[model samples]
Target: MSNRFKNLIVPVLAVVLGMLVGTIIMLVTGYDAGAAFSALFEGAFGDIYYTGETIRQVTPYILAGLAVGFAFKTGLFNIGVEGQLIVGWLASVWVGVAFDLPKIIHLPLAVLAAAAAGALWAFIPGFLKARFRVHEVIVTIMLNYVALHLSNYLIRTVLSEKSDRTPNIHDTASLKSPFLEGLTDYSRLHWGIVIALICVFIMWFILQKTTLGYELKAVGFNQHASEYAGMNVRKNIILSMVISGAFAGLAGAMEGLGTFGYAPVRGGFTGVGFDGIAVALLGGSAPIGIVLAALLFGSLKVGALNMPLEAGVPNELVDIIIALIVFFVGASYMIRIFIERLSKKKGVK
Candidate 1:
């Protein structure tokens, strides 16, 4: 089999195995597996509203997955994507609430603030790694807590007597599109999906076509070799982290501007960032792969809501299915070997 064709087979088999396992589990538990799956599909794509919701759900996942995948490409484990996202969310909403400008200016400014805040948030860990050889994973994990508390404190101090959330951003700053919403029958879908798709192509262009990306990838593959070749491994590491955080920050902006038009302080981390880790891993860390993986996870998430509502299946079963999918994806080497063996048997060169 050709390399491109082989690349497609493993993830597809992984998905199939995941669904098969989910079916077996449902059968054992006395739930109607067919009904559950039917409801899931219906919820994800039944109508304009459902389709819009699925797209809205997918938008943030794509950006967050890109964030994790980008860092992984540079051999950095960015555990703090969650923290960066929190800060970005707050920063975007803060800018949106503070600004009173034309729509074009206000919206772009808010988005830029979000990306900057996220990049800055990730910079701390990057700095530590570059200056002291400290592991990024630890620093990022600790910073996640710091970000959570810091945001909470700021919200209370700045928006005191206003509850956990900031005021809705001005129309100029909001990402909501009445025209698009009307087209989707008033779903929360917004312009963020377009931005996400653009970022996907940008990611592909950078990683596949840019010298900077080549240097970053080389450093990740072998820092000592890259250093001997006169590459600035330290600088590349830091730059990779910054870019990763920026992607995550954009995901937060999607939630703030498009989904909520404001941010509510949270005591705990949002799972989006962590889910992104799975997305990145399952996608083999490729730009296009990550987007496709995000779509799969997004559909499951959006569809799971209806399984319980209409099929008499527990929502937790959806979690089980997701866990199974992740498991199969992580163990997909078996599928690759199986395919290779079958190809050899067929003698197809």
Candidate 2:
């Protein structure tokens, strides 16, 4: 097989293996795997409404995945994406609620606030890692809790109207479009998908075509060599985290301005940030790969809801399938070796 073909082989086989394992589990558990999959497909793409929801879910997933993927490319692990997202959501809503500007101005302002908030939230860990050599993974993880509690407290003490969540943002700051929602049969689809796509192209352009990106990547590949070449390694490290957090924050902005129009979480974590890690990993930390992986995971999420409702399969089974896929992705080296061995055997014969 050609190199291009080999690159795709493991992922394709992994997907097939995941499905086969799911089927076996379903059979063992006394459920019809085909029926469950049918229900899943129906839920994800059987109709325009389902398709819209899947796209809507994919929107944030893409941004979140990009956030994590960007950091990975820079040799940083931004596990604090969850914290950054939470802070961004709160900041966006705060701006939206406090402002009464025209639509164009108000909307962009709210989004910028989200991005700024996310960047600032990530800056601490990034700075620590760069200046003091602190482990970013630990700091980012701890900051997640800080963001959750801070947002919750702020809502309770200041923004809440005798409720758990703040009031919905002004219509001018909203990303929701009446026409788009109607077009999707009243699903919560909005223009955020457009923004997500824009981010993908922008990230691709930056990484592949920009001088700054080249420096950042060089630093990631070898900080000592990059430093010898006169690159600002510390600056690049901090900048990478800031940009990564910005993308995650934009994801939270999507939920605030388009999906919910308010800041609300049932628990400490929204799980979207954590899901981004898996999405980034499965995508191999590539820009286009992140987008495709996000869509796949988004479909599974939307479809999982129907498995229990229509097919008598627990939704947790979908989680297992997802975990299995992640495992396969992580174990790709073994698959590559096996494929190479087979190729050599064929040549020898």
Candidate 3:
């Protein structure tokens, strides 16, 4: 079978298997799986409001997934996306609240601030990895804790003295759209979705059509060989991480400017960055695939909220289902082997 076909079928099979397993678990636990899933779909798309909210949820996932997937192309594991996102969130809010420029300048400035912060945060690990052979995963994981505490301290001391969150962003800097909100019964839908889609196109264009992209891929395939081929391996590594971090930062900007309009002292991680890893894996690190994966996850998340109200099922069941889907995705090698064996058996017959 063609690799493209294999890629397409794997995720589809994973989703089906995940749902099947979820149903079995529900049946074993004496719950009505059919009603639960019905509620899930209904909650995700029953009305314009729910649909809008689901799309809003999808915006960050798309950006975050791109962040991870972009790094994957360069053979980097950017586990510090959470930390980069946090710093980006803080930076965007700082720019939004601290300035009083025109809308054209202010909005872009805030967004750029976020991208810069995330890039700078990611640059540390990238530089270390290139310079000293440090493992990115370890550095990034440690940075996550540092980011959480640093953001909280900054919010409490510099951003706002009276509250745990900063003041709301100025109208000029906000991504909120009154028209979209009205269309969706005042849901938090915003223009960030457009930016996310644009990023998707940008990712595809860069990876498929650029010399730099070719170099990054070469370096990823084999660093020593790429270096021998006259590629600057270290430069490509740093560039890849910086670009990936920028995407991650943009994900934070979506939350800050589009969803919340302020930065708060987070007690824990937002979980978006971590979820991005699974999204990248499930999507096979393809641009379009990442968007589809994000949509599925976003729908599941929104739909889970309705389980308790409509089916007397806990929302956490969706988490379990998602986990199972990720597990199936990780085990796709075995599935491929099974499919190959069956194909050979059929050919012999």
How far off is residue 32 in model 2, in Å? 0.5
Q: How many residue pairs clash in each candidate?
A: 0, 0, 0
Question: In terms of lDDT, which candidate is strongest?
Answer: 3
Instruction: Supply the global lDDT for candidate 1.
Output: 0.90
lDDT of 3 at 158: 93
Stretches of candidate 2 above 4 Å error? Answer: 1-4
lDDT of 2 at 281: 85
lDDT: worst 10-residue window of model 2: 7-16
Q: On residues 1-349, what C-alpha lDDT tens digit does candidate 3 reach at each position?
A: 7777888998999999999999999999988999999999999999999999999999999999999999998899999888888899999999999999999999999999999999999999999999999999999999989999999998999999868999999999999999999999999999999999999999888889999999988998999999999999999999999999999999999999989999998879999999999899889889999999999999999999999999999999999999999999999998898778877898899
- Any residue pairs clashing in model 3, and if so which? none
Tens digits of per-residue lDDT for model 2 on 1-349? 7887776677767767778888899999999899999999999998889999999999999989999999999899999988898998899999999989999899999999999999999999999999999999999999999999989988888888657899999999999998988998999998989988999998889889999999989999999999999999999999999999999999999999889999874466998999999889878788888888899999999999999889999989988898888888888888888999999999999
Show where candidate 3 strays beyond 4 Å.
none
Provide the lowest-lDDT 10-residue window in model 1.
156-165
